[model samples]
Target: MNQIELKSLLADRSPETPAGRIVRTLSERGSMSAAQLARLTGLAKSTVSTALSELKRSNMVVETGSESAGSVGRPATTLTLNPEAGTCIGILIGQSEIQVIVADVSHQILSDATAVIEPDYSPARGVEVVRELIDAAYANQWRSPDALLGVGIAVGGPVSPITGEVMRGGIPNWAGVNLHEMFGPMFDAPIFADNESNCSAIAEMTWGAAQGFEDFVLYTLDLGVGGAIVSGGRVLRGIAGGAGEFGHVVIDPDGPLCRCGNRGCLEVYASFREPLAAAERHVGHALRIADVVRLALDGDETCRRLIRQAGEAGGRGLGLIGSVFNPALVVVSGRLASAGALLMDPLAESFERFSLVKGRDMPDFARTLLRPSAFVDNGACMGAVGLVLRHHGQPLNLPH
Candidate 1:
């Protein structure tokens, strides 16, 4: 295989190159028909056909069976990038765990691994965790790490798209760390970095709950209440990477303190940190957020109450987002979201109660819709791979 040719095609950023665009799109969006590619890439049908023919001839693209086009007598042939062409790595430096997923050009996951760590782990420790995870993932696999096209990083907090410098919203000690400066020398390929919530939104759009929706909001009710806004098929990362930081939105001046050092922030009220602690206290031992959710599902009233109260509080925060964006859909993400209707029912009720656009006042189609995330645990990690494939937020030579 010509690793250099695949790398060159992926590295070409020029808008005039349809073949590069086709490869990137297939890598990002997975299998789709030729017409879908033309519409998505804004290229002419003839141009797409020509580019696809060349890609197929070069063995960079391959057929992935066919799907009915609804109205067609002949089935539309679905196409995807050849899995052997290359692979991508998605790294999630999360609050309590570091995860890595290796996926091929066809979006097939080759290996995945996660290592639990302290919330306040050092950046050096994070790098070590990543190295170990990557090593384990590539072991015994048929693919070679040398053909890695790129790496995508999903951090717990917001990171500057241009500088790759992490902002205040992540783990306590991780603030002020430069992602590019730290991770750039570790690999031979490009690196894409973004906050975990933004990555989760990309996962939703690319492969999960928000599929087919161009506009939506991802409301995370985890240890820290965070979210991402997807407008017109793009995540709205604000100046300084603070956009969609719903947790930092101050709801009261005299309320409890937040991790972001704000008083009465929505996160102070909506975050699952306190509830998880309470559940741990109730259980008389340490428990993960998923454990609490499982207990609630298994008819434990104490855990149920904790999750319910969290949902109500998180719903209030979701109401704040609804007033601003009035988004078409809200994909409730994070571990707390795993509670299913046990969490969503109350959260939706609170959102309906607090939102200016009352559900009763509008028609069903006109009102906002809320959907739980499809990924219970690894969405952000998967979306990290999406960053490399989509070429979204790829860091330049970011100097400290």
Candidate 2:
């Protein structure tokens, strides 16, 4: 490729050129054979071959494993973007914790780390802590910071799509903080940002339970309740990027006040806080959502009952979602989902009872499939990495 063309190719973001189209396809569907790429990208076989050759020579692509030969077809070799071209960082600025994930250009995670802090830590403190964690991570790795493409932040609040500011009603301390500016100076690459639930949805759509589905809902039940909605393979960011604020949806006007300044919102009852409080009283000590789940799985009746009640409460909110989106799939996320059948059994049963469309009333193909997340924890941070591999935005800045 000529220098001009090569630079254009490197700078190009459109999925039109053979390389851009191929990269976009890989980002969406993952590794594939050349034939599959041709089919998916609708590029002629010769064009694909030429582009692949150039990409491989430029260290932008690499050969992975191969799929089994079909009944009447030869085995086809699979290819993916080269892992060495660059890396991306995903960070989850959660309510009670901050998680950081380091991943390559090809979506392979190199390291994942987390640090718990007080619930209302200031943004300045958050930046300091995250910077330290990131420094420690790179200090232990062979990868250089110069190769990083970008950073994607998934906050535990509503993020304005245009301003990248955290909206009020969630993470009060983070409101009005410009995300791009907060983490921009630490790294030399570009930064992307979104809500934590949206990041979870991206993780699910990219590599987890909702892989094949274009539309789904990610309902997270933990110390807090939240969710994201995906429609036609794109996360539904409302006018203000609060489209999937399921937890804040008002359900009762006279009920307990929610943290978001609302009364009787879904999260008021669905969140694990109530259960955790009950567990603390019962256990006579401190307890985390994960600890409760483990105890429940171990057959602690009180713990089990607490989880069941939380699931039942969550269903009331999800039932409203069912009436609105009626998605084909519902991927239950967050730490509570790790409870497996202990949580899902009751959740599914309650969902069916409260939802507008009854599962028995629909055909098997039309039923809303429910499954737990493949990630037991830190899904949002991983999804931040997903944002980079997919080239959803400009490359991230490498840490100084």
Candidate 3:
């Protein structure tokens, strides 16, 4: 019952020990019964019970509640991490937007805020905006910044995992910008950073459609087409943290010039930019991505056609992914995903046509599963929170 010993045991971030696995499991799943923990952690029941006893004695874990099935005579008590122990922050450094989400050790979001910035905002300006957002979030919530345990940032583009520097391709203004250097001065706690698409993947895995799947790909169709790849429960960050950058892949060497300075990158065609612009022209005014999606869902053929085309183009890139990883699941994300069947149906049809593996060629269990994301507006933000919950760090923070 040595509480200090238990804390010390759980404090180690290295994933080598049983205690580390247990701690990570608790962080990922807010609350669970001893049996559930044993099942989730794949640890022996006796081992889990022993660990729980130590954790509870140290005040690191607390008995939150109990669950009872209708036919069950006994209630199963639930245990959760001590909410008073710590807190975490998830920040999204997006294109023309910024978001901040605060949550406690128990993985419960306490407050969320967003700020919209003009395109090509300076790195210094971003730091200032993030600082103000964090301050405001804390001030409004009456939460002490001292309680913050870690911070996870979801950047709009490719990030250098080793140096925490933003790559030039995703966010032009953020080129050579070091994430840790940019935000480290604002907080004493650790920071985690990753690209927005990867963050979105993390969110999907933690709480959305990919919750139970260890391997999946997140294909985003929005103003920009981007994605992340997950293999064996780990995000496959290539040598330069560019492993899952599906959008930047040059599909046509002679095609239109892409923002990434590449010829015929998948993003140029697959991205919703052209369709969104078309929608604006048709509507005779500026329109948000969501606005177009709503119009399509409401039975506007023009809008519907626009989305369907985007889905078709997106599937071409997705098909290439199918040839490469042949992932077991694909989570279609971003604002366009909100269109649901209107988007997915055509997208799936196109995927089946273009992909090397066809549904008819594979059994039900082997066919790639495609699902829409749960959160449309705040997916990256939630993934930012996922970084805290899952301990997946970008360059800003060191991972254990």
Name the runs in model 1 displaced over 4 angstroms: 1-5, 8-14, 42-46, 68-74, 118-120, 281-283, 398-400
Candidate 3 per-residue C-alpha lDDT over 243-276 given as tens digits, one digit per residue, 9 for 90 to 100: 7878889988999999878899999989999899
Best by TM-score: 3
**Model 3 spans with C-alpha error above 4 angstroms:** 1-11, 15-18, 68-70, 393-400
Q: What's model 3's lDDT at 376?
A: 87
lDDT of 1 by residue, 228-285 (tens): 9999878888877889989889999998877677799998999888889999999999
- Superposition TM-score, candidate 1 onto the true structure: 0.91
Stretches of candidate 2 exceeding 4 Å from the true structure: 1-13, 42-47, 70-74, 393-400
Give the whole-model CA lDDT for all candidates, comma-separated.
0.88, 0.81, 0.83
Using lDDT as the measure, the top candidate is 1
Better of 2 and 3 by TM-score: 3
TM-score of each model, in listed order: 0.91, 0.90, 0.93
lDDT of 1 at 79: 100
